[model samples]
Target: MADKIFRNGEIVDGSGKARFKADLAVEGDTIVAIGDLKDMQAPEIIDISGKVICPGFIDMHSHTDMSIAYIPEADSLLHQGITTAVTGHCGESPVPVTNHNRSYFRNPDEIKDIDLPWERLETMGGFLGFLEEIGTSLNITPIVGQGAIRSAVVGFSAERPTEDQMEAMQQLVEQAMDEGAIGISTGLIYPPGSYASTEELIEVTKPVGRRGGIYFSHIRDEGDKLIEATKEEIEIGRKTGAAIHHSHFKAAGRDNWEKAEPALRLIDQAVAEGLQMTSDMYPYTAGATGLVALLPEWAQEGGLGDIVKRLSDKATRLKMVASMKTEGFFSIAEWDKVLIAGSSNPAYSGKYISELAETSGKTPYDWIFDALLETRGQIGMILFMMSEENVKMQFNRPYMMVGTDASGMLFEGPFAQGAHPRAMGTFPRFLGKYVRDEKVLPLEEAIHRISGLPAWKLNFKDRGLIRRGYKADLVVFDPATILDKADFINPFQKPVGIDYVLVNGQTVVKFNVHTHARPGVITTH
Candidate 1:
């Protein structure tokens, strides 16, 4: 490896330590040394006199599985200094293997949008190889999705895996771990994953503990049933003895915000009783998801096809309307707080359901039923269901990490058309609003939540810290001007003041702009 020296920069090092001045030397992808510039001799050197060099930010949770193929440069994320991301969250991802019913890895129909060219690898090694061939912007490791695997083993039917099917799922997890999946993930609220029983989850995730990987999920609910849902998760953790991490764990709805203590207490008890646990949360008051997720299980029984069929069936739709009138997904009051996130049909993007009802001359409930019937259940919404004070209270905890529950995307492209704003605005929003502006958390603690904490938790041995022998995935920024510019209406704007971002010794972002460099690698567990 040829030596390259980065001379004279202040290093934050991701250790929650105070910044210190240094000259860093890189040999190929890893930082070989860090010291005074006077001691450095390198074949090539770049002077970084007035910048802060830190360990690359690790996106603890991201949804870049399919989107990475669309935008390999990760132009937006790299500019914000994200060097590593854990994709395939929410139990959605494309895998490599193919079985008789459906292929492995590439199982769930969510990935059907992408024409998966490489499906026979059937292992993590091949998936990594395919990503390398496809090109990418940052280091990434995939979590073998239980939902995709379940869809592969037992089709997308909303039912439990039979005993035989259960064994097949067990085999799938073992195979995935052998391949390179670092952990297992599921979004219990999203079917066909929602249909999985706790025992079934325990059986499948037990292998993760056996293989030394973690188990994480978006549990069945984060609302009124959050306490029960949390206990259910802890029960699974207790049974499997797997290290567990909860995803986007904010208290939602009117009365649930007060339940954060008991929820965290459950995790704390699990820890005391000897189950290693951690969790991540986005620092926002609103939560985003599809309208389908808001429907009752019976309403979304089969799949998108069945959903469309039911929505279009006047009789079935009327029955659903009656059921939803009293028993909505989250709660009754939450109805007032729901807002449309991104709609492919710009005629409705960013409009609140209640507001739209007034304009369209219908009750909010009637409008929702009509909209679903009209759009065929394809629309998504962002709900200001989370309590703002609760978001701050949760983020203030030590165990919580940060994640953008969406994909990395460019400002334009039809692919970016109707996605949540989390993808574009998460990391910067944390630094700008929470840490700098609101003074919710100090910068060191915020960086720890975003970078080092996750690195240690994920066991990415060589990439989390900014020190000699570490990977040169680094973020340099002018903290004062660092802020996310993406808003609810136009949520694709790139952030400002992120001066330089390097991934594995290559400069992907310089002067706060993408440099047309693809330095990211397919990271393995």
Candidate 2:
């Protein structure tokens, strides 16, 4: 007898094959049987007669590490049918915290409500242990963050690491891999990680290659330097032999919209050359990041205190503004396209830079500087820069997978304030808008991209497919009615038509309502 059985559902299997009617049984945390199981007996039976059952969606790239400690329920993620999340993305992780980098490990303003167990999270092993102790709502696959490693050893300095420092960094990477991290990640556009030269990156990633771990990167540039950045990533893979996965691959800015095709061609060429290369993307034209990204790189160095000092200096502020103008900050014509997504002050939430600047009777740069200073550089902004045509083009690629690039959050409390719609709607929006409405991809192929492709890339042994011995992580949804309701203005709304979500054979979501079950485990490579 099985614990529960899903009957009369069309199974997609996350294999890119045609769907077929099947009855699936789950016992404990694993799928016990699949196929014609008319005689199967279970204490609980779900009649999913009109729904499609598929492997739970895997988020290929995410920053859930930053918020999982606070939002362990992961309501937004579970509601969207995400079963496993590959976190520590874009060069940020909570592990390997050292005295030198302790203050910078996580933003204090973001976690003012709860106390984190810092001592239990200083290492990858300890972090994983802590997660298990707390229990999460979805399986978490953590990766070592290059930025955090650099911060721990190099302390956010742009100066090249000493030979001893470089060795220390390598040791940290090795330690993380040994502690069950799947691979290493770099946020090349962020500080500390961005300060590393290409040679430094190749050197640091050597241990990952030796361990057969992947090297995931949010490349150095996404605008005017798109092609060059892509080439740099390839060079790192070529030199280090580490499998490469680009995070939230995009060509930002109006001038670089067409660069998406060429940049992807580089990936194709690299693949042809035998360098393992893949990419993930969210189904959105706009992207969200810290407002401080608008500042010049030099101005972003050091810690928050140093950055505040620089912002306080009028001469330095003027120089920064000039540099941003010259480099095309935000890469859009009007500041209105840049909306305030998150901030310490709620008044700024949901307002655009243009509106705030106009109301304050100040220049856009001045308003930004004032906002950053007032919030102490803790503001988040959503930039509307990418082209929808390019987004659809990327979605049609065979090598591309889907990622939310947003953290899990509930629809209430501090977590919901100014959250990106992608946090709650990426999967449904991709399935609803792209696959169902526009026909960008067949449902079978699209399901594979979100499930099987990521699972294979991450080398998951049994998950990501609805196989008889695999972990019982599954979702059942109505193909015709599934649609994302979250939008830029009202990002708190949940999607509709997802009927059930099971994590580890336990129902975490039923009919779009959270069951508050924390059955997720720390999945390691």
Candidate 3:
């Protein structure tokens, strides 16, 4: 006897093997049986004859830490069959917030209409407890953020840490690991994390390596110096035994697009030498981040507050503009490629900088500076600089996995406005466009990359496969009709063709609609 059963479906098993027709039964939260279970009796049975059944997707990289807190239902993620999300990516976890680092936490203005009840979570355990109290629609695998740890110890100063400060940082990493963080992550391009030296990173991550935790990094540079950045990342793994996972691995900017092949070879060579390494990417040419990323590192040195004052000072503003002009960072030549994804000003949302510059009667640089001021450095943009060919090249790699690098957003209210389409449509796009349409890889291979591969990378033994005794997290979808409706303009549209999604045997999504079930839990190594 079982609580539920999915009968007569093509089961992929998340193993990258051939699919087979079978019936699977779920008792409580585990898959009790998976085979010819025609004789199995259950309180509820689903007939999925023309559908494909596979383990629920595990998003290898995400930034849903606060977004999940804002909307625990996680409607967008669940609808796409994403049952487990590896959040706290790009070195921006929400936990371990201290008085010194409170400002580093997500501000109230980010999620405009929604009120986050708990603002100052000072520890990993505390943050997990708060999540449990609120309940979630899908499980979360949190990674301690390098930015949060550094900010907690030394504010946002871009200086070498003293001996005592370095020791404090190591203790923080150990404390977070003890509190159930699966690994540690760093966004080397962002402030705080970017300010950290390579030596400092190796020291802080040594504890993670000792505990067999992974090291996930958004490498320092992705443009002209992409290969150099790859070498730096590989050096971290060579020096430390921690498993390395590159986040949104890419070669941005058209001028540096040729670097993609060599950059990947560096990773492949590391793997050939027996270094534990892998990477993840979204099926898109554009990458999203704050507009401040376009500025020189020196302009963003102190922190956001200091940056605002710098922008206001006439002499400093001239210096910043002069630097940008000289460096050709986001110049008019690339202005059209920069799309305004999100901002406090709705008028600018979804419009290109080139278009906005024309309407404002200003240079692209001045228009961008004014836009940053209007939004107070919170403006988000999608830089469409990567090549489609390069993106497909990365997708063909065996070690590559999938991740949205976007937040869990809803389809209505403030959260719905100006969201990246990846947040709503990544998995579906992978299956529909890349697999079914483009015929890049077989369906089974894509499932393994999204499911078993990510689970294996995290060292989770029980959840990524649909074998007997494993957690009953599964998805059933129409292989012929699966489609990602989200586009650049309508970024909040929910995907279609996913029939059902379950977490811990509880139906979270059915008939392509969310059932509002909150059966998700926290997973730890």
Best lDDT among the predictions, by candidate number: 2
Worst 10 residues of 2 by lDDT: 325-334
Evaluate residue 59 in candidate 1 and report its C-alpha lDDT on the 0 to 100 scale.
Answer: 83
Candidate 1, residue 92: how far the Cα is off, in Å: 1.5
Question: Candidate 2: where is the Cα deviation over 4 Å?
Answer: 106-108, 331-333
Model-by-model lDDT, in order?
Answer: 0.77, 0.90, 0.87
Instruction: Please identify model 3 stretches exceeding 4 Å from their true place.
Output: 106-114, 117-120, 326-333
Judge candidate 3 at residue 322 and give its lDDT.
Answer: 76
- Please provide, for model 2 over 113-219, each residue's C-alpha lDDT reduced to its tens digit, 9 standing for 90 to 100: 77887678899999888788999999999999999999999998899999999999999999999998989999987898899999999999999999888999899
On lDDT, the stronger of 1 and 3 is 3
lDDT of 1 by residue, 302-383 (tens): 6666777876677886787677755546453455677777654668777878789999998776677678767656688888
Best-to-worst ranking by lDDT: 2, 3, 1
lDDT of 1 at 342: 63
